[model samples]
Target chain A: MNRCAVIGIGQTRHAAKRDDVSLAGLVREAALRALADAGLGFSDIDAVVIGKAPDTFEGVMMPELYLADALGAVGKPMMRVHTAGSVGGSTAIVAAHLVQAGVHKRVLTVAFEKQSESEAMWALSPKFPFQPPLLAGAGGYFAPLVRSYIRRSGAPPEVGIKVSVKDRKNALKNPYAHLLLPDISDEVVEKSPMLWDPIRYLETCPSSDGAAAMVLAAEDSLGGVTNPAWVLASEVRSEPTMFAGRDQVNPRAGRDCAKALYAGAGITEPRRQIDVAEVYVPFSWFEPMWMENLGFAPENEGWRLTLDGATSMTGDLPINPSGGVLSTNPIGASGMIRFAEAAMQVRGTAGAHQVDGAKIAMGHAYGGASQFFAMWLVGRDKP
Target chain B: MGEREIAIVSFAEVIVERSDRDDCELLLPVLKRALGDVGLTQQDIGFTVSGSSDFLGGRPFAFVMATDVLGAWPPIRESHVEMDGAFALYEAWVRLQHGDLDTALVFAFGRPSQGPLHDVMSLQLDPYYMAPLRPDALSLGALAARAALDAGLTSEDELARIAGERRGVPTSTSEPYLREPLRAHATPTLRDGAAAIVLAAGDGARALSKRPAWIRGLDHRIEPHSLGARSLTRSVSTEQAARGAGALGFGADVAELHARFAHEEPLLSRALELPASTRVNPSGGALAQDPVMVTGLCRLGHAARAVHEGAARAIAHATSGPCLQQNLVCTLEAR
Candidate 1:
């Protein structure tokens, strides 16, 4: 297979509502930025791959069809990927495969969500026959999982609070982050109302409108590009939503996905080799929960890594230096944002959040009640 | 990278005017038949992918629930596309090109019976410009049909004959128009359906079928969303995709065109440059039963079936968006 590399990355300034631009405008902004970053234009793209959570999120079914002209995909191969929350990452992986498979020399991949267009809660909680309503929204669905984690781990209550404080503070350094809370602190987090049991409002991600795009090229096509982030490996794994003995907290799909990813990249020790990480932490507790699931930390001990400041910007491995999904929760774009930020770190263009001398990084995303996983590893050097 | 040979080994679909069965229920039997056709079980598949729209189900993450049909117990390397099943098959074909994977299971399901399909499909238009105008899908088809009629590319009589022949019914030119130029016969028969196609690479493909429908070329393209911005009479995207997929030079023995509207058959036949001798829509095509998301994939399956069933070569065409704004073309040949 031909090697693939991330030649450019672009993202919108996440916000509660980007009323200034329509859905097409929002995506075009990111696509234009990505094309410019690659020192290319729309005409340079061989194909386009787009992903978003649900069409209901923006009241548009098959948005990519309408978005064809805006993305400059007219008369070119274009595809739409939808794997729920993991869609962004999955979209990127599919784009990379197109390059790796040598089908396309350059590919543009995009993911976005215009949450302001409709109530995602209403869309997600639609009542179906013989199926009970999910009135609690995403938080309600995950709070029980958090409670189970806490009960099993015996971790202190402050772990989630610490993660919330750290990530929001990190958001201050990211100009495009939606929530740059300068006043975020332990006191403020504690005062925040609890939306779900043991899950404070401050610990959850806010609904935001944004889009992220990446320009990926085959190794041979990276002639004019400098400092491209080589994609070492990409993997996606899925499991049935409900089955016997399925572990939601540390899902087998996640563990198997990580194992497959590392094995593909020939990385025996992820914690030591991976210089930085960008993981989907929609909820604060998901940081530690995903850490264990991704094999970054042992089961029940993931919180200790957070408490020890090991995941901080100045610590051993900075997680979500761009503040992650918690700070900018455009459901569809969240996963691609993680993947793009990881690439930026390796490209040494992450600006204030850049991990110093970072050569290798990991990006992870999960969706569908933690039953789906998409992960990729990028390095400064070609694999 | 070296190009790898991939072929469609098996195909199955369930089409109905309206399905009382749920998405999973509709998909289970199709999946079983698709797997059984290749003499392989779900466990034997290397990857699983699906294409569908959550909007059709009036819920979010609808495809996740549909995974129940795959019996995804041990977890699988899978992905999904919020598109026609042909796109999912494209993704699977791309995955198999990586050399590590062999067989892939692809399926698409939709039940348009839950809501007004015209209004539902209108949601696929541009929200800022087109959707607010609420131009229903049939109206768009009418507009295209009118454009083609005015351009002298086709006529009302030709459309009537195409519809009648495909539907195996008598066409009435005197019937009242459903949407100006488009009569009821010209519009698609919105239905509920599910389709599954199993793909295998190289040795696996040859092992699965006595005459595998080897995918010689597969490509898809999209056009501008605005109907006024481009010529509605011709499908530029389909022609481009046909050229890219190498379906232009070869003459197909049979063609399964996803002509959701009667007027689309002539547009696609022209775009694909199909031979006059080609037999189009032998299985009646989309006019017989248009199952939204599954209709496009069913075109591919039907075309593959021809090659698998001893035809020398065939062309499968799938379309998306309003007025044929997007198109996918695949060239299949027996090997």
Candidate 2:
């Protein structure tokens, strides 16, 4: 692949209702910021690739066409990618491919969701298929998995509350975070209503309306930026939702994606080597579950670290220092937010929320019964 | 030709007519054929990508069911786009440039019989502007056709001729006048289809096929959706894209175009401006099988096939979106 570097990253202020701007306006907010960061204009972008969770989530079918002008993709190649929750990461991977493939010098990638305009529950309502309809709402789907993790790993239920409290507290530093609960505590999370067994309202990600944008440029396009997050490695994986003997818990797809990401980036010990991680844990328990899946910790022992405070914001390895999905969950953009946040940490551009001395960062996201997985490892140095 | 060569090592298709089974049922066959054509299984294809839309199926994550047929049991590198199979193929091509994956599988499927085609397409128009009028694809083409007529780019006779030549079969025949200005024969037939293209790198191409359609140059461009701003008669986007791809030459052979309407044939012909004698749409093109999202990929596959099959020296052009709003020109030649 050609040398590709992320010169600019931008995001809209995450919120519950952004009625002030239309969907196009929501995306432009982030795109313009990213362009300015790259020290370039829209004219410098050779192509655009967009990603979002579902069309029903925004009530726009193939929204990229409507978004072409706002993104300055007019008279340029534009492609739309959809991979459930992992779509944001997948969208950036496609943009990176433009530079990596030696096709375009620079590509603009954006992912967003105006959840205020549509109901995620209604959009996820499964019909016309033989399988059982999604009933857990957003949290319900992951609750059983969380329960399985607890039962199989012998993890105490309090571990989830710890994650929720830690992420919400971290949100205080991120002004763009939608749910900045500086006052949130473990007791507050535990006191919240349990929407799903083993999962409380506070332990789950919020449905936010926001957008994230990143400008991926061929190495030659980089100019004024002193620190650039050269993309080290990227990978995406998928598996059948249901098969004869598929393991939804500890998904093979997530494991494969992480394995590829680490191997590509030449990371031998993710736990010791990875400085900061921004994993997509829409539900709190997933912080440990994905830690195990990504090989950051053993399968059954990941929760032990969470309980031991080894995975805290100031612990051995910081996780989701930007409040993660637990802070601002824009469903579609949530995945890319994780990816861009990783880039920001490496570029030393993550405002007050920056993880101090962070060098190697890994970003992760999963969608659709945890079957879709996209991840990338970014470092301070070009690999 | 570029430094790294891209090739269509294998292609598979499933014509999803009013069949007894569902769209998913149709996918297994096409996918198997595409993979088997290169003597490879799902595992042999290093990366997987797909394209589809939820509006057509009236359900979110419609493409999720496809993984069942793909047998992603061990999990595989995969992604999806909501555009067309052609764009997905482009994504695969880009991924292959990393020298990570030698072969990639690309596919797209939709059931036109399942949804109201015009209304679903209306969902693609400018929401604040044209969509309110419920401007279906035919009307959009009508506007473009009227513009072309006013511009004297081509005559109605040229469109009628294109309609007659694009459809050679009987059951799927085209008549004059579906939406005044766009004869029924002139409009590309609305059909349901599933298309898959297996792309390979230079070394992979050498290993897969004796003759591979070396993808010399592939480029795609989109014009703004605003009807008032864009020139409907000519695809300036297409011209710009062909120029960017450096695919402008008097192609001595042919150009397999994705012109959905009869009027579009002339407009795209003017935009890409293929040689006057170039054989266009010999496979009846989209005029007989206008499978929206997959049609553009089909045009690309057909052009590549023309080269690998030793039928044409070079082929250029593919037109997409409503009223030729977006276009792609991929110059192909056999190495």
Candidate 3:
């Protein structure tokens, strides 16, 4: 298979409402930036792959069809991917596959969600026929999983609070982060309103409108760029939403996907080998939950890493230096942002949040009751 | 087109005017039958992907519930697309080209019968300019038909004949126009359905089926979104995709096109430059049963089946967006 690299990356300033631009303009903002970053134009792209959480999020069915002209996809191959929250990461992987499969030299992938267009809670909690109402929204569904993780891991309540504070503090350094809480502290997070049991309002990700994009090209297509983030490995795994003997907190799909990714990247020790990671931690507790799932820490021991400041910027394995989903979530774009931020770290372009001398990084995302997972490893050197 | 060779080893589908079964219920049997045809189970598949729209059922993440049908106990490498199943197949084909995976499962399901499909399809238009106007799918199709008629590319009588041929009925131009230039018969009969296909590469394909429909070339292209920006009388995207897929000169014994409207058939035929000898829509095409997301994939299935049933070569076409703004062309062969 041909090798692929992330030659360009761009994202819009995430906000609660980006009323300044239409959906077309919103995506173009990032796509144009990515094109500029790559020192190319729309004409340079061989294909376009877009992903969003759901059509209902914007009440626009298959928005990619209409955004084709806006993204300069006319007379070009354009695909739309939707695997729930992991869609953005999967979209990037799919674009990379186009290069890896020798189908295209350069591909533009974009993921976005205009949450201001509709209330995500109502959209996600729709009443289905012959089924119990899911009125609790995403937070309520995940709160129990957080509780289970806390109960099983015996992690202190302060661990979740630390993650929220650390990530929010990191958001201050990110210019495009939606929530830049410069004064974020453990006391503030602990005193916040508790929306769901064992989950405070500050611990959950905010609904923001944003878009993320990346230009993936075959290794040979890198024009003059000398420091492109080489895609080392990418994998996606899925399991049934609910079944007997299923573990929701530490999903098997996430573990299986991470195993394949690490195996492909030849990383037997993720914690020591990888310089940084941008994992999907919408809920602050998911940090430890996913840490264990990703093998960054042993079972029931992930909380120790977080409490010991192992996930902070100055730590050995810095996670989500771009503030992560909790600090700047646009739902669909959140995953791609993680992937893009990881690429930025290895490329040495992550401005204030840059992990110094970072050579290898990992990006991860999971969705749909944690049954779907997507992960990729990127490094400074070509694999 | 990559280093790895891929072919459709098995295909299965179920179409109905309307069904009480949910998405999972509609897809489980089809998935089982598709895997059974190749003497393989879910565990044997290396990769899995599906395509469906959340707007079809007005439920977010509707495709998630369908995973229960796969019984993915050990967790499988999987992905999904919001486009038609044909695109999902394209993704699967790309995955197989990675040279690690040997087989993949692709499926798609839709229930346009659950809502007013015409109006729901309008939401696919530009939100700022087109969707607010709420132009139904049939009306958009009629506008294209009108453009074709005005351009002298086709006539009302010819459209009636095309529709008649697909529906297996006699043509009569005296019918009332459903949307001026389009009669009721010229429109497709929407249905609810699901489809599944198993693809294997190289030795795996040879081991699975007696005669696999080798995919010689596959490509998809899209045109401008706005109808005013495009020449509605012709499908530029289809022509481009056909050329990219090497279907321009490839001789095919049979061709299956996802032409929901009668006028689209001739327009696509001309775009692909199919000779008169190429039998079009031998399985009656979408006019017989247009199942939104599954129609395009069913075209692929029927085309592949023709090759499996002794056809020397076949070309399958799948389309998306209004007025054929996007198109995928795949050329399959028995060799």
Index of the highest-DockQ prediction:
3
Q: Which consecutive 10 residues in model 2 chain A have the weakest lDDT in total?
A: A127-136
Please give the range of 10 consecutive residues that has the lowest summed lDDT in model 1 chain A.
Answer: A126-135
Clashing pairs in 3: none
Residue B301 error, candidate 1, Å: 0.6
Cα TM-score per model: 0.99, 0.97, 0.99
**Candidate 1 lDDT score at position B14:** 93
Each prediction's number of clashing residue pairs: 0, 7, 0
Rank order by DockQ, top first? 3, 1, 2
Off by more than 4 A, model 1: A130-133
lDDT of 3 by residue, A302-361 (tens): 999899999999999998998899999899998899999999999999999999999999
User: What are the per-residue Cα lDDT tens digits for candidate 2 across B1-335?
Assistant: 13577788777776645555566787889898888888999988888998888887777888888888799878999998887787788778777777767898999887777778877788787667767788887788787888887899877777777777788633222454667676777776778888888888887797898888777777888888787878887789888877866667746366888887777777776766677777887778888787767887887778777776785455556554667667777777777
Which DockQ value does candidate 3 get? 0.90
Mark the regions of model 2 whose C-alpha exceeds 4 Å error after superposition. Answer: B169-176, B250-252
User: What lDDT does model 1 reach?
Assistant: 0.91
How well does candidate 3 score on lDDT at residue B162?
84
For residues B215-312, what per-residue lDDT tens digits would candidate 1 score against the true structure?
A: 99999988998887888878899999898888897889999999999989999999999889999999898888989899989999999999988899
Candidate 2: residue pairs that collide? A1-B98, A136-A140, B175-B185, B177-B183, B177-B184, B178-B184, B186-B262
